[model samples]
Target chain A: MNYPNGQKKQINQQNKSVKTNNNIFSNRGMSLEEDINTTNTYYLETDIAIIHKKPTPVQIVKVNYPRRSAAMITEGYFKQASTTDYNGLYRHRYIDFEAKETKNKTLFPLANIHDHQIRHMEKIVKHGGISFIIIRFAAYDETYFIPAEKLFPHWHDKLNGGRKSISYEKIKEEGHIIPFHYQARVNYIKIIDRLYFH
Target chain B: MNYPNGQKKQINQQNKSVKTNNNIFSNRGMSLEEDINTTNTYYLETDIAIIHKKPTPVQIVKVNYPRRSAAMITEGYFKQASTTDYNGLYRHRYIDFEAKETKNKTLFPLANIHDHQIRHMEKIVKHGGISFIIIRFAAYDETYFIPAEKLFPHWHDKLNGGRKSISYEKIKEEGHIIPFHYQARVNYIKIIDRLYFH
Candidate 1:
């Protein structure tokens, strides 16, 4: 049953033992965030790579004491993050990157990023850190890792009356495509090995 | 003015600036966190190194709106941080570390760190990142950078009835003493250069 338009329903929908006749039944179950979290967990469990999704930043203002032990949050608001979603160390080098998923097939919109993120990436690159963007066109099941240096021209051009997005064709040519697997949904380390190591 | 138990009067007596006679106050009147932030700003500006203090984590539960545009955070609680306070890149090498200040002149207590943070630092070192702890004997105006390899043994020794603290004298002998300038309160990169690069 659907709730009112503005109300969010909290449901525990984790039961998965039922026999399903169609692939859509299984596919319809998982949310994008859940799948990505699972992939990150898998990455962490294995010695493959060390990257983490930064927790959403929230500004807390008040709290209520329900009991001696269980203090509950009473008030808060979401805060804009100054850094990218993912950053970690890999193979003796600093890895800093932002991950974005788009449903659009034609182009990845520049509006997905903020100006502060661009400046942060610029600083990261200037300091000799490996910085990039991980763009996932989920509609096409395609993911690409584009270096920040390559994206800077597009960012500047977008400010000067160019297209406000990077077309799929440009990504196909410029960015390294990441291979997907059952465990590593966005196996970006492989792309790093191909581009930076070898 | 005096507080109920004379606490305010005692604190007020100690509130006078220690450098009242000097023209310059080194490190300013900032907390350890703020001093690191200012040092990071100086590092970023000078192309010396890149470092940042992670934002405090808060778990938000509710928000209120009395007006159209002004959102008031009414309920929230601070979540204890799982990672260290600072991390960054230096000379293409990943750097991960935590900074702690203690008033105890004889020993630096290990109770300031959590188990998860130690685990995080271990992962960082395993993946080729430079991991360390920056301990400040604030009473003595002394800061030292102790590498993770040196810390791990102490962590394990605590389980075997050994001392749960590292003495300042031991740190002075074993760890690298980080020099302080008027700008960089925790000038760790100099020690890093002497230890890692040189």
Candidate 2:
């Protein structure tokens, strides 16, 4: 059975899993980005939210427009993003967040996030938008939602010659654990509801 | 005089204009995108609003890791954007909009916007976000902000075998004219202030 253009890749992936006899659990080893993307798709389809991950920023320096083919980017470089990754509207509220996963068992380093992104989140919170970060402990298979307000004091401490990272235990204490659902794998919206709504 | 990396382009453009003796006005022939970017920067600096044009989406096919320099995208194709060109939080409201400039003197063609973008804008409006489109008539140097609600009727008409374009006069009557300012070039936030905040 042949699939259309967009569905082809998905069908091929499933086939590969089937060939490996790994069909029982489809999302066993999915990356954090893939899980969030799948969760976002489910949210959009169910009309629960309209969150979207912004595309990776690239600076195009050269292009090759063949006579019959699409315009191909021949030279490009990645640029530092000026804002958070995921943002949209949920329950009539502006929602913005960045998601990161760390393989370390003890701590999540502050260096994973950039300075300008922290400033951007501060502005978002000041403007009354709901801003947060999703931190995933890959070793423990646990994800936590930490509000921008909660992360700021730690960032300031690091700037003032304090610890360079947030301990896993500290995150477990301060952050809300995001439960995984089959459809909404990351399921950060549940945490948003608890934080922002009643 | 040596300029920083990002400042080099602006300095070069200014020097070119000076050499040609066309330095009376720096923004005489700027595109709508450039104007809006400048306006957003001004708004950000003044702490008035937070808006940003999302980066152009590209489907990267291949990349190369050089010995000492940056990773280069050797092959890629532009992807159709799934949402509006710009979205951000303003005065606690989620602001979303698409900007387009046309050389057509009498009408703005509906083909410039995609079906998915229209659906995206509709979802935004239904979710209580402020959604609109910025239509610029380059021939007359006039830009108008048409609310998503106002555009829906015209889009439906086109879908029902009616006129394929919205007349310039119709847009002028239905849309708010965005005033030009020296710093905030497009200045759509002024129109937003009147439409929503008031």
Query: Model 2, range B1-198, lDDT digits (tens) per residue?
Result: 233576656756787655443222333588999999999999999999999999999998999999999999999899999999999999999999999999999999999999999999999999999999999998887899999999999999999999999999999999999887789988999999999989
For residues A1-198, write the lDDT of model 2, one tens digit per residue: 233576656756787655444323333588889999999999999999999999999999999999998899999989989999999999889999999999999999999999999999999999999999999998877889999999999999999999999999999999999987789999999999888897
Clashing pairs in 1: A74-B74, A74-B75, A75-B74, A75-B75, A75-B76
Separately for all candidates shown, the number of backbone clashes (residues 3 or more apart, or on different chains) is: 5, 0
iRMS of candidate 2, Å: 0.5
- Give one digit per residue, the lDDT tens place, for model 1 in A61-115: 6567877665666666667888887778777778888888888999999999998
Q: TM-score of the candidate numbered 1?
A: 0.82
lDDT of model 1 at position A167: 96
Misplaced by over 4 Å in model 2 are A1-27, B1-27
lDDT of each: 0.78, 0.91
| lDDT at B115, model 1 | 84
- Candidate 2 pairs with clashing backbones: none
Interface RMSD of candidate 1? Answer: 2.5
Best model per lDDT: 2
